[model samples]
Target chain A: MARFKFLVAALAAASLWAPGASATVLDNVKQRGVLNCGTDNTAPGFGYLNTKTGKIEGLDADFCRAMAAAVLGDASKVNFVIVTDKSRFNALQTGQADVVFAHTTVKPVRESAIGIDFLPINFYDGTGMMVKSASGVKSVAELDGATVCTTQGSGTEATLAAFVRARGFKTTKVLTFENLEKLFGALQSDRCNAMSTDKSALAAWRGNSGKPDDYTILPETLNKSPFAGFVIANDSRWRNLLRWATFALFQAEEWDINSANLADRMKDESAFVQKFLGAKDGFGKDFGVADDFVASMIKSVGNYGEIYDRNLGPKTPYFIDRAGTPNAMWTKGGAEYSPPWN
Target chain B: MTTLALRWVHRNLFAKPFDAALSLVIIPMLAWAVYAFAHWALVEAHWQVVGGSFKVLMTGIYPADQLWRAWFSVATLCAMFGAGLGLSVRPGRAASTVVALGVALTGVMVAVAIDVHSGMLAAGSAALGVAAWCGVHHLAADQRIVLSGLLAGVVAIFVVLSPPGFEVWGGLLLSVVLTIAVSILTLPFGILLALGRQSRITSLRVISTAYIETMRSVPLILVVYWIWIIVPLLAPDTSVPGLLRGMAGFALFFAAYVAEYVRSGLQAVPKGQIEAARSLAMSSWTLNVDIVLPQALRVVVPSLVGQILDIFNGATLVFIIGLTDFLRAGQMILADPQNSGRTYEIYVFLFAVYLAIGGAITYASRRLEAHLARGSR
Candidate 1:
């Protein structure tokens, strides 16, 4: 009886860890005529479900539409599969989602151990601090003896400690709260001198605090947390298709070809522009899509900068300025770059 | 009348010095708290958040064009509830008042978030429910036929709602559907496990004990998450729907609890009843079914009803697997930057709905206890 139990346990473990049969995701998606794009419905400006429209509206959601347009020739042919922080990777591993764009931070262990490939970074996020405007503290360098609070058990706790130690602030005390709400409350009540978290979140909390001018976000970034989308590993054919589809958005922005001007650029006399837009000859044949797949994506969701502006720009409530951030195009002295379309 | 009211208050409030002092301090504070809460709820709270996101709160991202399926499913559910309630004993005054409050709240919410078509459907569903209740109550319908009919209604509702795909079934609708599915599916499996544990056969008893013990010891989230991950790994070719997988996890975990409840009921059955059935030379199946089960289930009816509430609350944990339930839906609404400051309104609404449903269940359980106890007494 004991041995029987042992055998049962072993079988269960074996089945759970066993490798699934690989099928090319591109073929499945093309045949299905719908792209299953996984994303979070709770992350504002990334992939939130807009209650008024009953539609997911954000940067990540537009990318899904763009992918659908590229692959199926219709932007509305995509189904938005809502995934949480815990289940995003499993959604891809189980073939439930063709690709995921859930504001996931690119990490080394995730790629190495989780059997998924990380795509190009879409947004650059990092730890940032916020202080009350009345305190008159300008930056991290001025908080020599101040107390800093962060959400407990988050990576920000360690980031805060390392920064304080490196800056040689002997009297700086670090505090941790159970959540951001409590951490913010502590800051408001003057229980802590500063509150720190992701820069995007810092901006959001400040924007929604009813009196946005009462708090000032410090002008120092503690660490890099570049966000990227991902897909299942060992499928370069599907991976390459998604990689270039993403790059096309960046390249379009670089070439000043937004949705508003796409038509004019398509009719341009330059052979390179025509070839790049798939008007005469294109890279789409090699990528297993239509010759004008790039045009379809741009037409559906616009260029990368436009997507960023639409979701996280000054018009939106959670606006984080992209003027000097790494999210800007390379030509504007930022890191968003695409290889030449030779 | 004034003198009598003063005397009554004096007798209750000033029976002891400490009691008088406590009443003096507490009554004014309670009144103030109630007034402040009323002021916030009525005057200060932004209810537009709830009105604006009513459809998403009710059905999540269920396509606008396919809302009729959800409405039809809701109508069927209302009919089933009405029929079920009619088959049971009539509610006491307290239960009636609770039901009236729930209905009034629902009416107010619907009026606030009114769309012409949905408003018509809501009225139709309530009418259908009332019609069902009247039909069952006046005609003296057979319980067995009504139960079988209700079962068919569940299947019909699932058929109507599933074609739009399982992924879109979310929000409060998802919570209710998942709760009902898990509650119904757990029943037979739980009974079998209970009987197996009480069986004379050693291997069967051991297996049932091991399963029940193992399941009850683990947290519910682990079971749900592992089932979600393992189903696809075990059957890599065919994609199992997430809603179905979530339901399976809930049913499996709750079955053990149901088993324990049923086992307690089984033990409560008198030894003499079993002896009397056996002395008549009745087969084990006939004895257990016709004799023992009725008594056992009667003793356990209140507990089983309470378990339905447990399942409803536990249904919220399905968000880990990406199925947005009622609580998750509210959170999704708050995630919108427009609704960010309306957290209190959304949370209060969710709290009121949960409290109403939970109170109704508790009232039903109390009524069942009284109803079942009448003959025994």
Candidate 2:
């Protein structure tokens, strides 16, 4: 038995020393015929697991499928590698995952220190204040001497402090609660004049609070926390392909071409539309994907707006208004935009 | 009969004035709580959420077509469990009847609640278990055969399930597999550590003590997370599956505790037993394995069984490394916005399952302790 145990240990040790592959990530993904897309399972409307269908369904997960469609021409050729916030970057760095769409915030430090390059911002989250509509406090400026509440130990506390100092609010006191439930409770009980948190979380709290109309979220965002999918750093080949694939989603929305209208757009007589949709000419040569990779992606998951609506639209409980936020398309007055497809 | 019932109730619940008053105060409240729970469970709760995702709850994200592999693994496990039971002392007639009734109840529930195919597979597995028990119950109990059978069963389960990839293994299936693997693998590793700690060789004793103390001092989550991270770094080419790494972490951590339990058991064995074996010119290997281990193991069997529950509970921490064990699977289900309103229903279901499994483990440990004690008595 001792000899057996020693043999087992030796075998395990022997297996560890083999050299890693040197192929580019894109090439390896293509050869492997599947994409390992790291994402969270707990975050609702982002990378949640849909139990009824036994499939991962959310904006982040769909983005993974879109990447799979762009690369493998089959949306289902991707595996949802469940990752936590702590392990997400490690997963990408270790080659355990090819790309991660786990709603990670785009911070300069992360990009500078971590061996990962950020993709285009998919969702722009920021601290926002909420007040009871009955209070008639329309904006943060109106809360001159009012008490504000936020979850304790969160970044919002510091951000709120900065905002209060910057705005020169003389008597605006910030209160902290243990969690969002308690913070919202403090606001509801009038213990605080307003509640502050991420705009997305604020929207979710209001939507699920059973009295959404009674509360109003202020329009002013306290700080920027734009989220984006990312891949390992210095892999420009894979990085560019994923970057353009995400851009394709934005451009598809801009062109009003979704999964529903993609067929009709394919029949468009316009040379630019044809080329953009890969009907006449193609962009796949530079990207090293199929000529119709964008079309395939659209057909699989749809445009950015459609994907967003599918996960975070009014039909879902976590509805965050996309009309006025930076998450909206550039054709509107929001920050999401794509470069010229040509 | 009425007087007899009254006397029993009076003796048990109302022997003293204080006891009577306490019983009066508590009984109605307990009754009200039970009634309220029953009412909510029967009428208000949305059980459709649980019913609809039952497969996911049982085997998270395991491919639908490859479900037979999971079922095969389950059948293998059930057969192994039955064989183990058969190797033990046979239960009394009343106990057998109770077991039979429980099986029947489970069958009825499965038939009514599950799809026909799943129900059939479950029935087949149960049948296999009974057959295995009948095949071995009357024969002479052989520890060697049982151990070899368990090892074969473990190998068979992995052979059947690994084709679908280990990462996709989740839900209760993942929890059970991790517990079983950790429990079995920890035993020998722990015994070696215990023996090493007692070794006269100074280096072996020092190394064993350092490892055991270090593992016991740190948190299990840290070990699991680091192993998950470091294994890939150490073996950059070969990607070790996350489940295997998680299992390794669990085995490494629990082996320390097991070592402690076993070391105490080793101490409990009389020094005279070793001396007697040595006088008989027994080899060191035979002395330890035949004389010392059996006596030491009998003392520690109950504790070792209890450790199975510890391992099962600890398995839930695998979520940090992103493996969806049972509790994490429930969280995954709740993460869906559509099921957000059914939080209580999902949580209640998860609580009930954990309670049931934990209760069974405790009961089994008690039974084993009693069985082991029978010899001394």
Off by over 4 Å in 2: A1-23, A129-149, A160-175, A181-195, A202-220, A267-270, B1-29, B120-136
Model 1 docking tier (incorrect/acceptable/medium/high): medium
DockQ (CA atoms), all models: 0.60, 0.41
Per-model lDDT: 0.87, 0.86
Instruction: Give the per-residue lDDT of model 1 (tens digit) for A235-335.
Output: 89888988988898999999899999999999988888888889988878888989999999999889998999998887777777676678778999788
The TM-scores of all predictions, comma-separated, are 0.93, 0.89
In terms of DockQ, the best-performing candidate is 1
Among all windows of 10 consecutive residues in model 2 chain B, the one with the lowest summed lDDT is: B83-92
Clashing pairs in 2: none
Model 1, stretches more than 4 Å misplaced?
Answer: A1-20, A132-147, A168-173, A189-193, A210-216, B91-105
Fraction of native Cα contacts reproduced by each candidate: 0.71, 0.61
Model 1 / residue B74 / CA error / Å: 2.6
- Give the Å error, residue B68, model 1: 2.4
Candidate RMSDs in Å, in order, are: 2.8, 5.1
lDDT of 2 at B247: 97
